[model samples]
Target chain A: MTRDRIGALFFLAVSIAYGLMSLDIRVPPFASEGFTARSLPLALSAAGTLIAFLMLVLPQKDGPGVEPAGRFLAGLGGFDWPRIAGLALNMLAYGFLLTRVGFLVSTILFLIVGYRLLGERRWHVLLLASVPVVVVFWAILTQLLDIFLGSALGRWGQLLAAQFSGGA
Target chain B: MLDGILTGLSTALTPTNLAMVFIGCFAGTFIGMLPGLGPISAIALMIPITYGFDPATGMILMAGVYYGAIFGGSTSSILINAPGVAGTVATSFDGYPMARKGLAGKALAIAAYASFSGGTIAAIFLLIAAPALASVALSFQSPDYFALMVLGLTAVSAFAGRGNFLKAMMMTVVGLMLAMIGSDPVVGMPRLNFGRVDLLDGISFLLLAMATFALSEALMTVLKREKISDAARAATQGRMGSLKLSGAEVKEMAPVVARSSVLGFFIGVLPGAGATIASFLAYGMERNFARGAKKEEFGKGSIRGLAAPETANNAAASGSFVPLLTLGIPGSGTTAVMLGALISYGVDPGPTLFTERPEVFWSVILSMYFGNVILLILNLPLIPYIARLLTLPSNLLVPLVLFFSLIGVYLVSFNNFDIYMMVIVAVVAVMLRLFDYPMAPMILGFILGDLMERNLRRSITLNDGSISFLWERPITLTILVITAVIVALPLVGFFRQRRRLAQAGEGG
Candidate 1:
């Protein structure tokens, strides 16, 4: 299938599955609360399936002429999957090591590597970017806001604290 | 108007607010000067810092950053041939060419004035229109609201997809489907959750937005070879010259500004259309309205040439807030990002803001004035100096942007996970931009995805499983009509062009 076709199909399949999922939901005041969760998916499925059918079946009598449109449609299917695979893997890895590695190492390592992969230059630029990102983020999360910065590793931050507090 | 404006000026003049606006203006000017980094990033970066402020003050600071960044984005486009934002790309044509012609001073002056003219005009439009739109929405029933959301989603398909209507429609449908991830809202049950706690809340819209816009842009940059050429470096001399508008120039551009403001504001107020379309439309309007021979002045550095899109884009940015603030409907991704900002601040934009939180409503309007004045002052004289930024190497510039983006995302939710998420997404975003996939629809998808799914379900459920209710409502019908008109527009364009071709053939 073409990318548009594949996108249409993938979306359609999920919509149907979600509709089934919503139908299986349990809720309050409906004879049985069991089916409440399934409603959203059901609705989404209907819309999804309908849209996918249109995408798949409809000829789109009007397009940007036949040749370019065909190439455009076909090309969309050929996303640079290897690069995307790297991006997805980077995210998955970061998500798992989030608390264990601390924000600094994980964020910079990923961003610097990602930047290099995406065609940035200079070793100095990469190294410099990592430090401020860590410190600025640490300040924003721990010192400033109530966002979900995990301090489960807080006590160990004594090393960082000691650095700031003159070796305590 | 003076009383209100002066009162707002005074409110903005407080020491802390003044400092904040100054800080915001400086940061906004630079960030905005960079094409892709924008007000949402500015606001997201500051959200952590503003945690200590009073709510109104916090909001004012954020607004300063937001408006400042938008005005700043116009600067780089005019001088460096880089549009700091997607919306500013149209500005680059006349803007850069004007600089190349050694009219950097004149161009900067005109752009600053145009920014204020459009900004003030649209601010006034927002002041007038938002309340009116809100009051209309106040009378809407649950059925009306459900329909409104659908209309907004349909708008995504209409605006984003121009030549390829079905492809745009397909994208919108996919977006709506992506929104269905996570637990069901009404039943409090996990539909797509698959027993994982992480999936319960669904994908973060910010993450998706990062992936699509920021990440995709970064990805696209990799494939494209650009030497960030600031050709105006030699042209723009030491200090910027006067800000005074010449009488002859003013007389010539007066009508252009007036027409563009109206055209831009109307398009901006629409749910899906953006500054790009509005700017293009305003320029077209100007072309149509131009004197018989002056049409050639366009694309050749005419003052009116520069003014049309500048006025329209800024006006569109401000006007886009009408649906967002009044009716809780966002017109485009930037506004959608603004919606996320509002949510992050615990401020739900709806009738309640008008009824109970008038301060939030009026103060935001008030802040736009302050932000605009700050941007005008900061941008004009600083244009020559700020133009130096273009000479900064991409090697240094790119990594810093990556750093800030990383820091910005992490501060939002200090989970190292969010940071990692940003880095990974930024990479992908960079790649996508390398190719030709439009990033706007993806962010639009991520933002409105869940809302579309919820409303679609609600509309159907309220009607007891019949699709009839969707077509039964008059408002829905009106929306459907508008949608049909839009869907038919491309076909109309195609046939009209084809007819012109036939006429030429006959004449031959």
Candidate 2:
């Protein structure tokens, strides 16, 4: 009915699923005599399940809770669902676009969108701020550290190669 | 011992190592001064950069960040009444009042000097103590090591924040489960990879650390919209007069600093007791020790009130390294991340580290000395400028941090999938944190899980699969007993609280 109860139920469901999955682990024949792969997992699952069960039975001391089951569904209305969902979608899009669009482009786009969502209204500030951050981080990561940033740069390299070959 | 110190000095005093130390300290201080960043995030964000370095250099850099952040945290506490890190929370008690009284510069100066004194004193202790402790740990067998890990795991429950024992334990279990993913530690067989090639190495420690500390923090910042605009505005308004402590004031605070430094170091050496506890303990002890008008002056900007916690917390930050370096058991989340960094650098930290890699040991220790000097000299004059950074808009800060996290995660594994997985992990971590679940135990559990399992299995094998090996050895038995006591003591407190609540309910 409360957040605590919802958390308990979630943990309980996860423990059960994890316990079931761990049961399918097959120990290799050459493994030495002792605890195998499933040992800690099974133990963890059991401990988690037990704790979750206790959480359900024992009322939390600090807050007001122990309401009806209908309140569990009602609690969704209490949260800032739209904002949270928007943030989640923003992150998902950023991650999805990262490799496709490349580091510099995706990062700048993500920052602009993220800053807006966080209530920064001035478009000029967002545009001015995002470019320097993207450039600086790009220089640091790719040029300084020599980490291979993906996609857009790689595409540029391909185009250069094609043009040089064609010219030859 | 003298030779080791000399050798450490030789290693750490090199120009590159010295530069790394300065960079680490400066970045640590700068980042830790930001609201909601803290020492853990500072350390976590720096790990990717350290991959380019050797083991000793990486460790020296990390060690610099560790204590530098502690020093930096007091700046925010004093200036903005927002403790940049949890350890500095006690500093705000008297610090903000001191600032309100127009003694901001004096309070900042005292805090810097006190921090220097505490850190220097504790480094002296660490120099003597860590090697001796490592020598003692050298004789530890597999079972004893197993018991020690268990003790470390159990001790988390003791300090796992207010009354969430079961939740903390659940988090520990979950962390262990997460650690069990990827390949099997003992047999070299795939266990929980679920047929994904990317999961073969399991989850990257860098990714886990970033997601748990950095990404989750960004999400929470977004949700809360906690702005430092006011603190920033106020920080720029006035002249911070006289960044110097008077002679009499220095003389008065010296003994208090020394006493709290010693008390804080021992507290820091104990597993799971960190800077926050040390600072609060020192503050409380000082309050109790004060008499007459001085006692009443505590909350109203007493110099002793400001000095005690500042000194002790710095000392405790230095002391926390003792367990991590010697026993390979980290008492706090930041040190646990350090342990992960050490492991990533391919230097297994334990008793053998003293003999095998004395350079690593000594360089890190020597770097702390340099780091404290750097902080003392640099922190005073720069306090005004550093305080101004608190005014940086959250919109810019949050996105910048998120960009760092995303790129840092990708750089480590160079895999797009890891970035995707990191996002998922961050979401779960944010939810867990929202529910007041402590992430430290989970991080420690993940860091210690593999070693714990290996030692445990080896011990069992040596004992012919007999579980009694745990209790048969004196050291093992003693450690297990201590672990039992640590775990049980909290449950005792929990029940007592419940009983009190029940009694009050009945009376009402």
Candidate 3:
């Protein structure tokens, strides 16, 4: 399918899912005299569904020409899918590692991996670039802003301490 | 009016506010000179840092960044023929030719002076017009406000690049859906949380903005492999010749600058007609107005050609603030981001803002004057140093951008879940962007969605739940009619095109 078709179908699915979920919104009895919580969501989802349906039927006038279904399926291999996929995975891993390790450790690791994925070759350049960025951000956010950078080991250590104190 | 001006000057002249203005202008210019980052991203990246400041100070900083980015955009356009932002694309027409002729210094200097002139002129106009416009808006009711918000949302379709009206509208509705995720503002009941306790307070606007603008832009750069060429990088080096314009050149360009400034400011006042459109219109008008050899020199390094767009774009940048400050309607994407910032700072930008938060209103306006002066001084002597930023590799910049976004979002709530959500939002935004979907309407919808809903509900309740109340009020009716016409015009054109294509098929 073409990009427009894919987009339309994707939005169509989302609208239906969100519409169904909106049906479960609970309104309070003593609420103000006006539209309830579910009203806007239902209206938005319905409008979205209508627009998405129109998009499916309307012919695309711009961008790359539409090709056969087989070509469309094969087109996946035409672009740099691996790089995109690697970056996405890198972001997910960074998020997971952020809480597991700490801000500084996770940020440096994420940047190094991201640099390699983007075709950076020199290890020194990667370390030199990523480490300073991590340190600067850490200093600004933690010291200046006073936000805590949580770590998995810190949480685990707290849990172990709580268990020992309870046993004692 | 004079009292407000004095109050604004006093507020903007404070040590901290002056420092904020200088920093915001410097950072805006530096970032705007970099490829792939525009004024919108510049503002979005700086938003997290402004959370610790007062509302007036934050507004001043953002206002500085807003116009400062426009000034910086022209540097890349003149030097490398690659516009740093969309608004400066027209600047490259004659600017690059002048650079090839080794008049790069003159071209950069002219652009800086023209921008300063336009910005200062538009600041004067803003001072005169905003208060009057705010007074008019002060009498507005809930229904009128509702109509105005709808009009603002619909007007974005005009700027939605190419023929993606439906796609833009779809993105807008999706934004509205996203805005509904937290507890209902009206009833205090949680909805769309999906049973997550972290979502009860709703998704943070900071996270959404960082994801949509900054993080998504970084990911797209990686996916598309956007890079500045080595040749273009080298072009930015070397001794910049005389930075001074001859007396005659300045005298000749003065009228063009004045004319384009006025034209650009009016265009900027209209919703959805932003700096890009204003610059193009000004450039075209100047070309038509030029006579003799000047007309032939348009694309061949004409000073009038270069100055017209530079002036108009900066003027338009200042003019776009009129609707945002007075009527609570953002005329462009950058202003929409600023609108979100304004709301986040608990400084609602509407007619009442002039009366309620006079300091915020006046200080921001006054700071634009200082910002333009700062940009001129920074751009003239330091063009070479500033141009070096364009050489920074995308590979290094991309990771650093992602790092800032991650830390910015994480710092907001100190919740890892928000970071995860930011990544998700960024992924979704990138996917939509690949399909030519415009991101501006979605943001506009997201920012105004809650207000739109509340006003709508309140209006209906005033009329005892009668929907006809919308059509009964004259202001609401007129605004809605205008909105309908704007929305329907594109659909009408689409159908006409379809019919013509069908006829052509039959003939073929």
DockQ score of each predicted structure, in the order shown: 0.31, 0.54, 0.61
Task: In angstroms, give how far residue B309 of model 1 lies from its true place.
Answer: 0.7
Give all candidates' CA lDDT scores.
0.66, 0.84, 0.85
User: Candidate 3: what lDDT?
Assistant: 0.85
lDDT of 2 by residue, B1-508 (tens): 7887888899999998999888888888888888778888889998888898998899888888877788788888888888889999999999889888888899899899999999999999999999999999999999998899888877776776665777777777787888888887877788777889999898888899898888888777666667787876686577576787788999889989999999989989888889999999999999999999989999999999999999999899889999898988898888999999999999989888888888888889889989999888886788788778778888778878887887787877767787778778888887787667788888888998888888988898888878898778999999999999988887788789889989999999
Give me the displacement of residue B53 in model 3, in angstroms: 0.2
lDDT of 3 at B212: 88
The digit string of per-residue lDDT tens for model 3 on B1-508 reads 7878888899999999999888998888877877667888889888888888898898899988877787778888888877878899999999989998998999999999999999999999999989999999999999999999888888887557666788888888887888899898876788999999999988887788788888887787767666775745778765567898889999999999999999999888888788998999999999999999999999999999999999999999889999999988888888988988898898888998899888888999999999999888865788788788778888888878887788777767877788778888888888788666878778878888888888988888898888887889988999999999989888888889999989999999
Model 1: lDDT to the true structure: 0.66
Candidate 2's TM-score: 0.94
Interface RMSD of every predicted model, in angstroms: 5.1, 2.0, 1.9
Going through the candidates in order, the fraction of native interface contacts each one reproduces equals 0.39, 0.51, 0.76
Which portions of model 2 miss their true places by more than 4 Å? A30-34, A63-84, A121-123, A155-168, B497-508
lDDT of 3 at B136: 91
Question: Which is the leading candidate under TM-score?
Answer: 2
Taking all chains together, each candidate's TM-score versus the true structure is 0.82, 0.94, 0.93
What's model 1's lDDT at B98? 77
